[model samples]
Target: MSKTVTFVILLLLVIKTSVVCRAQCSQGAIICETFGSGPRGLLPQGITNFTYRARACPDDGEYTLLDTVSGDCHGQAWHPILEDHTPNDVRGNMFVVNASYQPSEFYSQKVAGLCPGVIYEFSLWALNLNRILTAGACDEYILRNPIIAMRIEQPDGTLIKEIIQPAITRTATPIWVSLSMQFSIPTSSNDIVVKLVNKGLGGCGNDLVIDDIGFRPVHPGLSIQFSNSPDAETTVCADTRLSLTVGTATGYISPAYLWQQSQDNVTWTAIPNATLSTYAINPVRPGRTYYRLRNTQSINASAVGRAQCSAESNVLVVNGLPDSPFSLGPDQVLCEGTTQAIPAPTSLPAGTTFVWSDQSKSQNLTVSLAGTYWLETNFNGCTYRDSVIVESQNCRLDDIYVPDAFTPNNDTHNDQLVVFHAGAFLTYSFRVFDRWGNLIFVSRQIDVSWDGTFLNRPCSDGIYAWTADYSVLNPLNQTHHFVRSGRVMLVR
Candidate 1:
């Protein structure tokens, strides 16, 4: 045989192998086809025959098979018409259609071996051939805009439903565009027909190519449940073993697992080598840590099957308590007969019990008498204790003295009017007024004294009427009020 005949035979064999591979479904996929078959029926080499035909074609059949490197029917090269190489064309071959050739033409196939009543997703990649095949002759009549329609029909040729109408627009470049839709198969139907139609008028630019068609069944939803060994919020000592369990009520096909840990309980990171349903943590740290499980897998099987299908388990927190209970506060003082309550540590772990020094099991201790108080926290078969000291004061009031005369002559002695023994009172107020009853001085502090001045200016020496009101704590811890009035001589 000649070299030319040998090359042609080799090419035919290669194309056949590609078509067989493309027709096979991927793992976990039901149906897939790349249209890599060589010329057989109405289509030329590299096109698959359609199952049914609706509209007629003027030049060729409803669809034609074309290689991206090959030109139009005139055999012109199509490199100038395409912007970049087709990204979605996993295989170099695809099926092409022109709507202007007739009213409209579609390539369809009957899909078999599907689970009844199960949801299945169908998807394919399409590209618009925007380059003009001829010059200005057919340019005016050609419509470059294109729309592709996808539909599902019963085996009897009746339209079951429109999966996708004329909605997808083709771009100017030969870039492959993806389209997909999900539908549930009817219980009575054993097979469904899928159609891909080019809805653009094809005088000049309404050329489209479709490839990499696929269909698959997938789970609708994902849910995960978690279980902890000692239960959530369990308190344990350092170096204790903790077990976390994760499971799914609806076991999806071949789901992946990942366990995550968090310190602040907000930001989380996956644990190393923790890809399993159960995770174990030995020698826990001396702080709080959170754990959760995540499951991910491929779902909604279609062109976008690799889209994220993930579910996360609920969070479980385990607290590690210290060997000794931490103190809530330092030693404190309380007035005599005044009650004081010591608060318990808020960091105490779960499953921990509190015991007061007075044989009480409450979280806090309230005492009216002055003495030392302590708290004991028990957790994880161990006991820890902390203490606090409380003191009381005895306050009494005998008498209060107010100076009636003062010499403000630049000498320190008797330079201001003042009150003495005022500290014995709980609350007191002193006010001095001029003879005209206009208030000149006022103070609430017991040690407050007034210089013979108003607004920082010395006042005339005169007798200023003064009034004092004070309260003292009696032996019963009740307030007793007293009012006294006198005259003070301000001799500047």
Candidate 2:
């Protein structure tokens, strides 16, 4: 083929394969599509001194668009019902869950300027509600965000709380309510969790749109610091050493490090040579507690530390659950072809991950096959664990059996034999033969007893040979195999 022709043919072949592979993919999975930016969907960007017609304080705006199937879609407002609506009026995005806050996008495109102490102001047209049906549909969502969590926050002055945004109802003409909030952190938070939120509904994962998010400034020393981190307050196995980080300022470099922690954040105790980037949170106590970094220099422009450092990383919380205490839940046998969900509790402070002894992460599982299962959850800190077991549906075998040897001599008792499964379908075959590999009587699913009949009536008993065949699984991948051969005796 010519170069041009070859390239065209190859390109066509590649495109054809790509399309077929995605045939069962999401693009093909969508059953329906609709478009309506809700009362929250109204954009205020174009009109300065925007004009609108609202008859009441909590008025549903006029000249707005919304969906009949989905409720008021908007951003900026506190949705009372926590539905996943795009409040930003952006056409393409959906809502998703994080533990604390219900955010706007699953793939929230980078907001370019997200950093420490920066205050981001949220702005969007919120939907005025209660005009629409506040009552939930029969198909309200069932949440499903199951995660192994580790959250780091300087919860000191920063009001760091997980948020679940409500889904709002739709009204006539869909009125818009504008809502706004701000968040700022002075320092970095370790163990910051990036996770998903389950809406608990039938999977209504909604994400909204966000615009005009910016950083606002706060004062100095307003930042509180934590020293002995990740294990802010954790149960450590005997003699397990703890480590916490000491931070320098956002802009400047500190000459040295000083670590001070308290049995409480109050009454102070100092570690003699704890001058380093990370300190050993020692003289470890029992039960719950807190710790903070001691700055050698005062945290002010005129003083050394504020010019040098301010906030410690977000506080780390470690819980020391009892040693090797195993846990498991969803204690039920799952049905075939359906998934059963099992939840891991947050009670175990040390355990960080889960493993099925059989290597399955099936917190929720479809018991398609029968197997013995166990769950092993681990502690990321010191190697500790908790584990449990699960059982699956049983499989059955087909019965097919017949007598190897039989004497049809008008004998009454102990004359014949057969095999069968207690409750199931059956298939069978039986045969009798002489030593020369000649078949005497052979039949499949033979219901009548063999009477040692070569043709009919009784026959003589000798070392006559025979063959029997039946079906059963080999316990492997459940394949079918046949067994053949044997010898039998007939008596007169």
Candidate 3:
């Protein structure tokens, strides 16, 4: 081989591998191609056999890159695609191709820099872009389905794997489907050429749109959860410990692990001696912390924290609350007949809740009796308590009133004798007598009155003596009993 011939061959090889892209993938998988962004022009020369078109629609043996698909084709026989298959991509481009009249290679690219002896996955998203109907045809099986052959070859053109994908048939609506194959890079080769060859001829159908082509390592999923909590995110008091566990992962012959911590989710630090499926977090400081697990092969220690080489678990967030600073005030004094409101706790964490000794969650506790009142606040699996001692004292006295004179002339004014007192009366009794000491009127009821008549006969209207006994309660809840006598004049 001449020097110029070798140089030309190297140039062609470089062009073949230039289409391989390292885009984002699910869970750190490597997406080789997403057809670039919207308004993309054309593939570099030699990347595909099909001629490239700048327009939205392509004819037979031609292809194009478009963000969205619309308009009618072949008498409105094709389905319209509203978006590309790339996730979270508002205007990502997709490969739209119409097969040629004969079976031929349509796309080819050489993937390089693969890790040998590692399992890798090759996949793509495909959509059957045609919606054809056969006259009176059942099962909608009128048009020719799209079929393609995924061929993998070593750099020396040695075949490694070939998968004949099933024919993508037409449906009532356009749907994007996924097709994938897994392989291990042989020890002798670290690069391979991937080729997509059309297996069906183009005519009334066999049209398809392809997007999100990927070539990545096959890693088992890693999901981290709190061992004691059903939720991944939780709050804890200051200086609290936590236990975390990862879902069982398969596929690695000798799995290695490392536990990592982060103040914010963006930056991570590996924990010393924390290499297992489960990890116990030490007492966390005040603030938010995040945790995750990284898994790789035991032989690949250097790649343990590298996302492209290791499988990372789902992030677990822990919000650490600072120590609570609050007081319920000093011992309080209350009167027996009065109530006082104890203020509620303020400036506590979001999830903190409290309950009083009476099992009430009201904003404040109303206390009237002398006792010990307590409040217990529960926050992030911890409890705090405070109490106040209440004492009662006598503050006011009960008063009583008795009439001095009355005339039972049936004029409706001053016709009877009555007794009155404040509402503190607990027990009462009254009696009336003439000057000869005869019990003319006796009563035990507080509201009863005397009319200056006994046995339906009018008595001589003279001074009458009245005796009464009663008990009254003060503000201190203590009852006081007293006996008294008074004279009343009655005239008819």
Please, what is the TM-score per model?
A: 0.36, 0.20, 0.51
Q: Which structure is stronger by lDDT: 1 or 3?
A: 3
| lDDT tens digits by residue: candidate 1, 1-492 | 000000000112111122233433333344455655443234433323332222222133345444443444323312223322233444345555443343343456666544444566776665654443446454456334456556777888877667534433444345666667777666676477776555544344454555666665554443333344435577777555677675442544565667778999867787888877788777666789888766644232221212222345667887876554578588887766578788887787787887898989766789888888888777767677778888776434546677778998877888878787623777789998999999989999877888888889898988999988988877777888989889988887
Cα lDDT listed for each candidate: 0.58, 0.36, 0.73
Q: CA shift at 473, candidate 2, in angstroms?
A: 99
Candidate 2: tens digits of C-alpha lDDT, residues 104-154: 211111122123443323223233332222334412543222111111134
Weakest 10 consecutive residues, lDDT, candidate 3? 1-10
What TM-score does structure 2 among the candidates reach? 0.20
Better of 1 and 2 by TM-score: 1
Looking at candidate 1, what is the lDDT of residue 438? 93
Comparing 1 with 3 on TM-score, the higher-scoring candidate is 3
Using TM-score as the measure, which candidate wins? 3
Clashes per model (N, Cα, C within 3 A) = 3, 42, 0
Q: How far is candidate 1 from the true structure (C-alpha RMSD, Å)?
A: 20.4
Tell me how many residue pairs clash in candidate 1: 3
Off by over 4 Å in 2: 1-52, 55-243, 247-282, 288-315, 318-492
lDDT for 276 (candidate 3):
81
